[model samples]
Target: MSVDDFKHRGRRKMLVDLLRTKGIEDEKVLEAINLVPRHLFLDSAFIEYAYKDEAFPIAAGQTISHPFTVAFQTQLLDIHPNEKVLEIGTGSGYQTAVLVGLGAEVFTIERQKDLFDFSKIMLKKINFEPRYQTYGDGYKGLPSFAPFDKIIVTAGAPEIPNELLNQLKVGGIMVIPVGEESQQMLVIIKLSENQYEHYEFGNFKFVPMLERRDK
Candidate 1:
């Protein structure tokens, strides 16, 4: 954990202003972004650049999504308080904290062991304890915790995982990025048991979502 003093808070306010200009209109989403201490989510050397609306390198060869991207996806989720939100990649727990701050009951998964471990401790240190944090395959989703109210995948996938789609409750929404390289942000609204509505929100890049290869 790192100190979040006036310096970091001022930077975050500026970042929120930048995000506003970038079209992040959800006040709750913007407030969450402003509240979470992104500087603490990065390595010390890059702390100065933490609130610059840019992605920074983190453990497990992953990059935290830029603040704009995070806010965009979050705004698309249309999260409501107490919603059961499943986060597919807990890189640095930054987004998870944002969700928690938005009053969602978050269940986050991290397939990379290093990140899974680091984030578990980091989140605890800051007291942003999500409802559940698991080290497992994102493609598999969380069966026992099925029927999430909203789901956010933090990585780029070659295609949307049907397994995850199965875990969503009817009338829920899922915001994911799908592509081989740069991904188009997709919003999947579960209409019924077998019905869904899909929409795209332009292209963005993210760390590729990884799966566990069975032997």
Candidate 2:
């Protein structure tokens, strides 16, 4: 096969593996992951490996998370078709695109200026740019758009921010990876006033969440 044909087939195979083998069975999320061109989200130098279920470095010493991570994180959000969601880390906009494709009205924030710029452009390129209320500091959830039905933090935090918890509506859910040296991902579900439940899923390493002093 020609080089171009080989790459196309490889991407298709990757998609199948993600759905059938990786346990990403949500039809909506799977379809979105397949529809959004992963190659377009990576640097031209890494485009050939874009479809692989792996992480790749981007600017700002950050990496676009693995595709399985994206699917799992998104699935944990339990998004409703028209729910408003807040994403703390935009990264490469791959996760943002998936959220939008799942029919959630997303309000995403990115602290790193270069990453913010890149994600904005890439999201627009795929016509998947969400409600995009970018901020430099993700520690403070988008309070102005508070009462988000769901909030997802892509970066790992030492602890859940009070502001983020306050932003969630009663009976809402927030998926975050929290830790200092090691990370444990969990889903926090708000039961009602002064009541919340937490479930630990698994352990994973991720870029530490940083506070943007200038934001």
Candidate 3:
């Protein structure tokens, strides 16, 4: 490995350590976070800060989520190998890459066309192939690919969308942030055919989950 590659690996290890200190205890989630190079998903200008547990602006006014947020959400999902997972936002594709690394069959959607296109290229370049990388409204979810084992929403929604709940398989989990401009509640829902359970994990801030595509 080159000097830069070695440095990046060291930074990833440090990042994993930080995540552990912050309560991210899922070994699989930590492994995936370390394996996927977060810097590659960021703009070159912000590459140096890639491993920090912080969010950064990306194209289409979106931001790549903080590492802690990503790890937190992924850990909540409790992903299993080859399980079908629906991701509501594909901004920067960093989270998608981590999910892919964790052995989930990822189907991710982005509302902004620019981010959709950019993330597709970035994920492909990194050899992180999601089952589907779509450009569409996240609120709609992906009906055709319904009944996912898990669902993750990267943006903050005003409320949980019924469409997403409908797409989740019975006993599946969905992690989302729900609120307006300020702090949002990190919600986890475990769905059954006729009933669902909700768990709130305190506050987190995310870009608003917009409806329709930005043309």
Candidate 4:
């Protein structure tokens, strides 16, 4: 069979397996996973593995997040239909596209120019373009698009970014991975005007969150 055909079949089956076993309970998120063409976001060589619940290398030393991770994080956000979202590290635009499919007005940032450009093209190709902008420094988040209703960081940071926390609107949620070495924790931070509530779900590992590589 053709590579494209294989990818389509393989990814569909993988999505089914993920929902069946990964404890991913949200129907809307599952449908988005089923509907989004994950293979298109990956390089042709790795397209066959697109649907498996695993991260794959993308350009600029970044990796596309696993499908379960994407679904789990999206579920944590509890995003409303009209909510605005800020995504840090738009590696392959896969995660961004998922959020868009969930009806979010997304704003994303990537520090790697190559990945940023590639994701921009892919976003346009998939019609997943965010509302306000995409940037090269994810650490800074999007101050211009401040007060986002939800924020999801796809990479691992040593600690949660204070700037990103500040940008979330009251009652907004930010899902991120925090760690230093091998293991990272998926943390959900719910913002309030005066206080924040945090919940750490489980362990994970991701590409390190970067500042400006140029600098």
Give the number of the best model, judged by lDDT.
1
The number of the candidate with the highest TM-score is 1
Candidate 3 lDDT, tens digit per residue, 1-215?
12239889999999999999999999999999999989988888888898999999998888999999999999989999999999999998899999999999999998888888888997888799899988888988999998899999988888888888889888888898888885455555555576888888878889888865543
| Full ranking by TM-score | 1, 3, 2, 4
Task: For residues 1-215, write the lDDT of model 4, one tens digit per residue.
Answer: 13346559666766867665879888888777776788888878876667777788888877888888888888888877779999998887888888888888888887877888888887787687767556568888888878888999888888888888889888788888898774455555555666788888888888888854543
Q: Residue 188 error for model 3, in Å?
A: 3.9
A best-first ranking of the candidates according to their lDDT comes to: 1, 3, 2, 4
Runs with alpha carbons beyond 4 Å of true place in candidate 4 = 1-10, 212-215
lDDT of 1 by residue, 106-184 (tens): 9999888888888899899988889999988889888899889999999999999999899999999999999987999
Question: Looking at candidate 2, what is the lDDT of residue 118?
Answer: 86
lDDT of 2 by residue, 80-187 (tens): 798999999998788998899888999999998888988898788668989865857899878888999999999989998888999999989999999987789999
Worst 10-residue lDDT window, candidate 3: 182-191
| Range of the 10 consecutive residues with the lowest summed lDDT in candidate 2 | 1-10
Q: Tell me each candidate's RMSD, in Å, in order.
A: 1.2, 2.8, 2.1, 2.4
Worst 10 residues of 1 by lDDT: 206-215
